[model samples]
Target: MRHIGKLLLLTSLLTSSLAFGQITADPEERGERGAQDPLRSRTPEGNPLPFMQRLRFGGGISGLSIGNPFSIGVSPVVAYQASERAVLGVGVNYVYTRLKLYDSAGQRYNFTANQYGGRVFGMYEIVPKIIPNLYAHGELESISVQDNYSGAGLPVNRTWIASPLVGVTYSQRIGRLAGINLSALYNLNYTTSSTQVYGSPWVLRISFF
Candidate 1:
């Protein structure tokens, strides 16, 4: 009789454990738990978000007027969120500049130029758990600019130049799908000469996404 009682106690403990596991392992319960997790990449229905939902579009515009020189530029970008921590994009650039110059003979003239380019870029989140809005950025660009080496009075020609840039971005989310970003970047291939398209190595951009 004692042996039968011991067997019954062991069977009861095993059955209780199996029942508890079944309760905890229900698919609906697990799905609800996963949906509540902020880090999980899922929709309200516990389905993965579509590709179009992960795409981001943004651009920046700039204008400068300082006496003899006037400049305006636009840069537009289309990006894809590859993961929670990474983004990849492509962009185009257009800039119009007009400058008043004095020839060697003391004659004043106007120089109008157009600079256009395209770039490929990538960004990675930096310590996202601690600072979710900060990102590290890198880009490779090829631009066409006026060949200033042709001398001040000669007819201008256009040439392609390559620029590599690295920087950081601070992004502020407006809602789930929109945000504003400020980026400060440095051009590694910048030169301090007339052939250079940009006057400065430092480039600051404010964009919307």
Candidate 2:
């Protein structure tokens, strides 16, 4: 009876030790378990987020009416979140521009042209924890425009122009899955000799996603 009693006490001690070890597991082990927990997988709208909630769509539009030249354009983008801090996207743009010009004899005339283009872009979050929604943006664009250097006077020929742009953006969340972003970019390929589509190297843009 004495030996049986000792055996039972030893068994109880072993079970208690095992339970205590499980209850007080290492913090890293607990974190790993928490990360895998399905109960914590939720979207901002309180719905269950899928394994890859990465695709996003956004775009911007601009209209300008200043006397000599008037222009209107639309840009639409489709993006994918590559990681926690990186995003990649592609976009298409169309602009209609009307210009008032003078001939060599000083006669005023109105000219209308259409500009169309496509771009691929990438963005990276800058110090996400410290700077919050700030991001660095880069893009490569190819546009079809009238060749102004082709003997001028209505530009009989069309050409493709390539522009490389770099900038920074500030993002603001408007809803659970929607956001607005403002970016100030500089064109790296801007030159006086080339057919300047944008007129300047600086571009300010506002977009929604």
Candidate 3:
């Protein structure tokens, strides 16, 4: 009888130990398999702002001879892309000129004078057919000219001016480091000091991609 009792107690103790072991293992097994959850495999989605894209830096010469004084100018442009449809740009232009006065002879004017100016512009894409793009931009231009000849040499010339301009442009990519721009622009007078008004002009620019 004593031996049977001892055997029964041992059996009960073994059963209790087995139950405790299973209870402790439940959490560890869940932890090892937790990576299979769908939430753990995916990330949240959100929106972000676009970044800037910069194009080429270029300098070129421009001239006009129709009216007023014949002037030649050097202009340089630096541009940064705001998005696929927009660009932010700034430019500086300097002009050297000689004015021909009607009814005045033997009075030749010479000037080392020029205009110093800065402009800020924003361009937006409006059409995208038959070409890679078509864009329109508006700009504010402030120009200050230094008259090089005065008095007995030549008559004093009018200088400082500010105006607004609207333009349309198209661009096509050629090869690496090569592209082209076709553009037209109109200048509007916003200040009283402007004389020898300028009209709309067309331009074509070649670029490198």
* Candidate 1 vs 2: which has more lDDT: 1
The list of candidate 1 runs beyond 4 A from truth reads 1-47, 62-70, 102-109, 149-153, 193-196
In angstroms, give how far residue 48 of model 3 lies from its true place: 9.6
Candidate 1 residue-wise lDDT, 1-209, digit = tens: 34334433543443232210000123564465452213223454556556676667666652222344545556667777666567788888766666677879999876666678898989888986577679999988888888763335777878888888899988776535556778888889887532345556766766665
Candidate 3 structure quality by residue, lDDT tens digits, 1-209: 34334434543443232210000113333365452211111122212222221344444443232444545554566665555467667777554444555445676543234456877777787864334357786777777854443333666575777767777766553332223445555666633233322212432222211
Off by over 4 Å in 2: 1-52, 62-70, 102-107, 148-155, 193-196
Model-by-model lDDT, in order? Answer: 0.63, 0.61, 0.46
- Note each model's CA RMSD in angstroms: 23.2, 23.5, 31.3
Model 1: ten consecutive residues of lowest lDDT: 17-26
Give the per-residue lDDT digits (tens) of candidate 2, residues 1-209.
Answer: 34334433543443232210001123453365452212213443444445345556667752223344555556677766565467688888765566667879999776666677899999898985478668999998888886552224553567788889899988775534556778888889887622235545766776665
Q: What local lDDT does model 1 show for residue 10?
A: 42
Prediction 2 global C-alpha lDDT = 0.61
Candidate 1 vs. true structure, TM-score: 0.69
Summing lDDT over every window of 10 consecutive residues in candidate 2, give the lowest-scoring window: 16-25
| Winner of 2 and 3 under TM-score | 2
> Where does candidate 3 stray beyond 4 Å?
1-55, 62-68, 102-113, 147-159, 190-209
The alpha-carbon lDDT assigned to residue 19 of candidate 2 equals: 11
Candidate 3 local lDDT, residue 187: 64
